[model samples]
Target: MEISWLGHSCFQLRGKNVNLITDPFTPQQESAEPPATLSKINASIITISHNHPGHNYVQGVGGNPRVVRGPGEYEINEVLITGVASYHDDEHGKSHGRNTIYVIHMDDLVICHLGDLGHALKEEQLEAVADADVLLVPISGGKSVTATQAAEIISQVEPHVVIPMHYHPTPDEQRPAQLDKFFREMGVEAIEPQPKFTVTKNSLPATMQVVLLTPR
Candidate 1:
């Protein structure tokens, strides 16, 4: 599978048979950096984490893609998707509302997308996302989990590869940088950002590792 970070929490995943886009974000005027111009998005499926404008700009995405919103189990185009009910805030949606954690099974690899997860994992949530090959996590603490919380979740999930998202990498006038703090918690000094990432089941590392991808 090929994973391309579009910006913010948006990612375009291309598998053998289908193409999926997760959390497609529209740029906010007050934001420091603008999101990618999502045009000609030939996606077979689009999984939304919540109804927030930055994560739910389906109108901007091209192609008549099937959109999945809430929690459920679905199988489309030979891909098995399981949505686990989660909260966007520690108070169970009282603060930020509900968030959906999507686990996608494709090419014999499990890819989990934790959309704006505000708290640490519970026993049930951990079981639901067991044996994840690739984990897309949020470290911004901007309506999501903090760097310390993210590190704790990583220890619990034990995914083969963890990709940090939803955090600002550079100094932006509109947004505060969070990657530095997250990296400090993870004991990572620096990470070279790549444009995209491609991996298969056989290519997965035995131990957990963090991979940074530059928004395309």
Candidate 2:
């Protein structure tokens, strides 16, 4: 399977028979990095973590894909997806609102996308994503987990590969500091970002690995 980041928490996960997109954003949302246009992007399935403009915007995607918006279990085109209810703020939905963490099974691999997850996982939530081979986490603190919290989540999941998202650092700003803090917490200095990440079940890493992907 191949994974590509599309600005913010959005990602395109391409498998042998299915293509899925997670948390597509509207272009109107302000960000340090401009998002790739979703106009021509096509997906067999589209998973929206929440109804927010930055995470919802289903009309932006093409192909008339099947849209999954909340907690549920779904199977389409040979791919299995489980959406576990989560929150967009630490206040258990009081501050922000509900979010869905999607655990997808495709191409013989388990991929977890934590959409704007605002707090550390509870035991049940951890169990839901414990089998993830690749974890997509939010490291920006606005409506999601902070850099420190993200590192903690990584330890809890212990996925073979981790990819950080929702962080768009601009020069002369604090976002860059947050990203640096995440790198420090993960015990890394820097990693060159790749355009996309490609992996297979047989090629899974024995130890935890962090990959940085540039938004397309």
Candidate 3:
């Protein structure tokens, strides 16, 4: 399967028979800079982590895809998806409402997308995502976990590969400094960002690996 980042927490996962997009962000009207455009992006399935504008803009995606918005078990086009209930804040949704962490089974691999996850995992949450071969985590600390918390989440999930998201970059100015903290917390110096990431079951690293994907 191949994965491509589409800015913010959005990602396009391409498999053998199915294509999936996670958390498609709408254009930020308040900002002077244009947000990532989702025009012409087609997916067989779209998984939404929450109801926020940045994560749940279904109309922006084409193909009339089946949309999964909350915690549930769904099977679409040979892909198995389990959305585990989570939160958007540390206070059990009192501040930011509910979030869903999706564990998707496709192409003989387990991929977990933690959508705006705002806290460390509980025991049950950890059990649900412990089998993740690839983990998509939010590292920016606005409404989700911070860089330090993100590293902690990584240890809890213990996935073979990790891809960080939800942080600022370029025009935002704080991108480099924010990511630098995450790298330091992860005990890495620096990793060059890739345009896309391709992985197979047999090709997964024996140890946990951190991958940086440049938003498309």
Candidate 4:
């Protein structure tokens, strides 16, 4: 599988010769990053974890993607997408609307997008997270979990790889910090990957680690 970060919580993952994008927000809005145009492809699966301005702008993501409103399970196009229910805002799932987290499992990899997740997991939620090869998280403060909470989830899920998102304030965004605090809390050497990252089943590590993607 190959992955590209399209700023904020939007990540484009290519697997099974197709693409999957998560939580797309319009750059004109409160978004800090602009969309990455990979003209070669359209998003096959678009997962919306929440309805926030930063998490759900159909236009910014571009193309006609089969949007998945998650918190449950669906299998299509040789990919299994399981949506785990969560809270959209802070206040322990009390604010905004219900948040959805997606788990994309394919031939060689399992990817988890914790879209604007506001709180930690219960035992069942932790069980769902444990299956991921890569865990995509929100590191910025506010409604989403803090660096401390994210660090705890990482400990519980123990994924082979972690992709931190939802921090990083570009000149365009008004947010405070980026993924640095989350990295320090996790106590791992963060790798600033090329705009895109490729992985095969054979290359997965047995232990968990954090990977910070360089935005396009």
Report lDDT (CA) for all predictions: 0.87, 0.91, 0.92, 0.76
Provide the lowest-lDDT 10-residue window in model 2.
Answer: 28-37
Largest lDDT belongs to which candidate?
Answer: 3
Clashes of 2: 0
**TM-score for each of the candidates:** 0.92, 0.94, 0.95, 0.87
lDDT of 4 by residue, 1-216 (tens): 888887788888878766787887665545544544433347777888877776776655546778888667887688889898878665656666688888889766889899888888878878887888998988786778889898888888888988888876567633345555676788755555566777888988777766656776
Tell me which residue pairs clash in candidate 2: none
Off by over 4 Å in 2: 29-36, 171-175
Per-residue lDDT of 1-216 in model 3, one digit per residue for the tens?
Answer: 999999899999999989999998988777644354677777899999999988988888888899998998999999999999999999999999999999999999999999999999999999999999999999989799999999999998889999999986787534477699999999987888899999999999999999999988
RMSD of 1: 3.1
Q: Residues 1-216, candidate 1, lDDT per residue (tens digit)?
A: 999888888999999989999998876666544344576677889999999988997866767888998899999889999999999999989999999999999989999999999999999999999879999999888699988899999989999999999976564523235777777888977777788899999999987788988877
The true-versus-predicted C-alpha distance at residue 124 of model 3, in Å, is 0.5
| Comparing 2 and 4 on lDDT, the stronger one | 2
RMSD of each: 3.1, 3.0, 2.4, 3.5
Report the lDDT tens digits of candidate 2 across residue range 109-204.
999999999999999999999999999999989889999999999999999999999988575534477778889999987888899999999999
**Candidate 2 RMSD computed on C-alpha atoms after optimal superposition onto the true structure:** 3.0
Q: How accurate is candidate 1 locally (lDDT)?
A: 0.87
